[model samples]
Target: MEWHNWSGSVSAQPRTIARPRNESELRAAILATPRVRVRGAGHSFMPLCETDGTLIDMSDYDAPIEIAADRASAWVPAGWSLARLTETLWKEGVSLINQGDVNPQSLAGATATGTHGTGKDLGSLSTQVIAFELMLADGSLVVCDAEHHPDLFQAQRLSLGLFGVATRIRINVLPAYYLEERVEARPLGEMAERWQELAAATRHFEFFVFPYADTVIFKSLHPIAGEDEMPHSTDIDERPFRVACELGRKANFLIPPLQRLMMRLSSKPSRRVGPAWQIFPGERTIRFEEMEYELPRADGIPTLLEAIGYIRRKKLPVAFPFEFRLVAGDDIWMSPFNRGVGSSISFHQYARMPWRALFAEIEPVLRGANGRPHWAKRHTLGPDQVHALYPKTGDFLKVRAEVDPAGKFVNADLARLFGIERK
Candidate 1:
């Protein structure tokens, strides 16, 4: 049998698959295999989950959420999907501090990859974690937190599953809140003209702009009194968009006109009020290979425009839109948004369209702007590039080595990126 990621861009044929039902079983499964790699929701676009030794699945490992006595945080099973975790937390009168637009990722997977939402003051999910319970390479369990194991905790915040296998995560939460979501179509020029005003207008703000199009789908979400109106239905047939992508795939030259037509038809005004969890994640069934970069906030607009200009000038048939937003920074050792307030730009292409070559052509534009790619997204950085972009790569590797000395979690791609020698 074969294991593949959401976009079918990465796959692995492991020697064995272990589905652990409990901690004892999980430990036994790990100790029984010479090498192990944990499995999450398989949402990563990169080869993070590719393994040849043994693949361990924890989706079946479920437990009740343990709220802190002060009600400031909760211990959640790392294997639970963000969709499940957020819904469950809402019922407990609490909510996650922030959430990404797509929510199928496991709690640990999101945190490890520095998954985030749009907010100038809100940091990524990794920053919300208070502690972690991990299973080491020797199958021994240990807990790490700011007070107990500072170095390990710092590294685990965004370790990309390198340091250890996270079994449970202590995450901060807030009193349940509601949000009013608004969407409108606007001219592309408006992005730069009112960048500061737009970012400050809402708690969550973002825009999606297809490379060949002149308009953008602007979206904003802010706290609301309650659900005063019906929420937007997520039940529209996506065939129209899919058909457009297919047309472009067959005849690349028709991309620009097709995109303009689609944008014109999609221009509409709509609003919805719903619980924060429900409003945070949008339905994302359309498959696309994505590459995301985090840059200094000042360089966002110019860099995005340059990249988009190149696509338009070259008549590139890129099929998906570029998502642009803001994310607060953190001190996490391996986080791309750790340096300072950052601007996040995500480049995507319809899964069926030609992508790698275009990504190769544009990755340099981002890198030249001092951008750092999301670990789980597409990027072709060698070890030196990785070390240069992340000054703490040595520190992260040090902790990774200390926890998993035998390199139990290192796979071929990871080995190449981290300069680790594989036996």
Candidate 2:
């Protein structure tokens, strides 16, 4: 059988696929294959999970969530999806500090890729991990945390599943809370001018700017001291937007007009009060190929403007909105936001439409701004480029070697990513 990622951008026909129901099974599978790649929910757009070797699917490892007595942390199954984990946490009267717009990604997958939510004070998902239980390529289980195996902890937090298979993850969480979500529209110029001020004013803030239109949709999520109320409506309905994307995909010339119409018809302000988890993620029904880059917070607006200008000048047939967000930095060696405060600019195109040329043209603008591509998104960077952008690349490589000396987990893409010669 063949396997494809969520966006269908990457596919693989593994020599063998294993559905490991327990650690014993997982360890056996790992030891049996010379090359292995663990797959979570398959949300990544990159070939990180693609391998002609063995593919270990951990979804069947349905372990129960273990909450700490103090309610400050929880040990969760790494295979659980964000939606499942957050829902369980809510029932336990705790919640993750932050989360991205979509919730289908697995916990290990999200952290491995440094997936993040929008907030000036919040770091990426990897930062929330307190510890990890991994099965090394030799089929030995090791527990790593800030205190035990500190270097391994830092590298494993965002290791791209290159170090080992994370079986369990301990995450720091907060008491369950309510959040008030507000969304409104504004001109792109005005929003960009006041981006910092606006971001600082809210607990979570992000915006989406239509490619051909001047309109921007501003979204803010802040904690509120009140009982949760059932939201009257979802934050944003994607059905209409999905239809617009389909139309834009079919008729390239109609993209601009479709974008204008969608922005005009969907600019109404909306507010909703709900549990933090419920309010954090928005609806995403449309399938699209995405490319996101994390740049110095100061370079966000200028880089975004340059991307928009380039798109307009090229008359690219793009209709999906450009997503802009802020993220706090962490010390994880492989995290894109490892260098202090950062801002992310994301570009998307309907899955059926060609995105390579469009992304290829805009990648230079992002790279010129000293940006690092998100690990799970579409990116063209290879080993040399990656090393140039991430100063700690050697450190991560050292840890990878120590953990998987035989290169049992190194696939073709991983080999190129770390500049390793396959034995």
Candidate 3:
């Protein structure tokens, strides 16, 4: 909602949008509407938050966070954006153990959808969660964690916004540490050969491979020992070829063919270094829809290469680069990396192109390799398939039924997806 979802690909229409200032208001809204769903930053490419009944905007629920006296943890309002939360917590000398690239997402929204970043040593953001306060549809509040209401805690961590509205979350905090990032253009061959070692070497690791280009950008990050130390050796914009590539991307639609042309013409190695956030937040000005999957780390490289080969052979206009990342698994029920280390492959095509065909071409390859789709990203899998994938699906539904038996918090789509019918 803050940025109109920038993606602008949503198709859902809400009967009304409600902004609640507190738990009582949210409970009242839930009870009042026969059907409802919560909307976050609207970053989800799919219509998970879609509802004809009502939409709850938790944006107004932002409240100041409090750090624990031990400095080991802190609590934040569910609706707070990652950007504001990080900036606020930085002043208190603490930071999230890991953060996704873009920080514009709300806390509950990001966690609910299993949004993540890459790090073998570090896990996805939700894995750092210590506890949360959930406002149930029946106007009751429940606190959950690994010890208290363990089932609810696990399921709600990445509940796809189906369980209830989370009002606050408490997460383990790490001492704020500066990060030094290194980036280099490497051959795809190197990625295949050293993938395992590379994943193990850094605090965070990711790569980008442009279609029709022989080169791949390998990026790594590590914690810096001291403050005030510069993260990278040189300015990121020094590479004229990379700069040209970035500029040309802005006009990709008018010059879609130019991308392949540029890749062929300016084929050269490039490098850059900076802080973790700076390096991670690279410009993705090109417009495209993404489908990502998280798989066990051991199967990651093989699955990705096989998918890439399929794309190349099929000659899909997949002009946008592919993204590969690693993250430690969490207990979040619907998270792709829920139970183990995960390797993610995100592919995209220009927005104007027919997404249905492209996605159809790619889905089989991903599914063949045991990949689980990112809940917020584009994927056709509904509740039946979702239950088959997640181990705790049944338990989550049982609890959800008890908490919102009237289906007050469920949208029609969600009801069908979860196979829940109001009695």
Top-TM-score candidate index: 1
What lDDT tens digits, residue by residue, belong to model 3 across residues 74-158? 9888888787777777777887778887777888888888888888867777778889898887778899998998888887877
Q: For candidate 2, lDDT tens digit of each residue in 268-322?
A: 9977888888888766767789999999889998999989989999998886888
**All candidates' TM-scores?**
0.98, 0.97, 0.88
Q: Please, what is the whole-model Cα lDDT of each candidate in the order they appear? A: 0.88, 0.88, 0.74
Candidate 3 Cα lDDT to native = 0.74
How much is 367 displaced in model 3, in angstroms? 0.6
Q: What is the Å distance of residue 224 in model 1 from its true position?
A: 0.8
Query: Candidate 3's error at 293, in angstroms?
Result: 1.0
Q: On lDDT, who's better, 1 or 3?
A: 1
Q: What would the TM-score be for candidate 2 when compared with the true structure?
A: 0.97
Writing each residue's lDDT as its tens digit, candidate 1 over 308-392 gives 9988787778988899989998888888887999999999999998789889889999999999999989999889998888899
Model 1: per-residue Cα lDDT at residue 192: 74
Residue pairs in steric clash, candidate 3? none
In candidate 2 the C-alpha lDDT for residue 4 amounts to 91
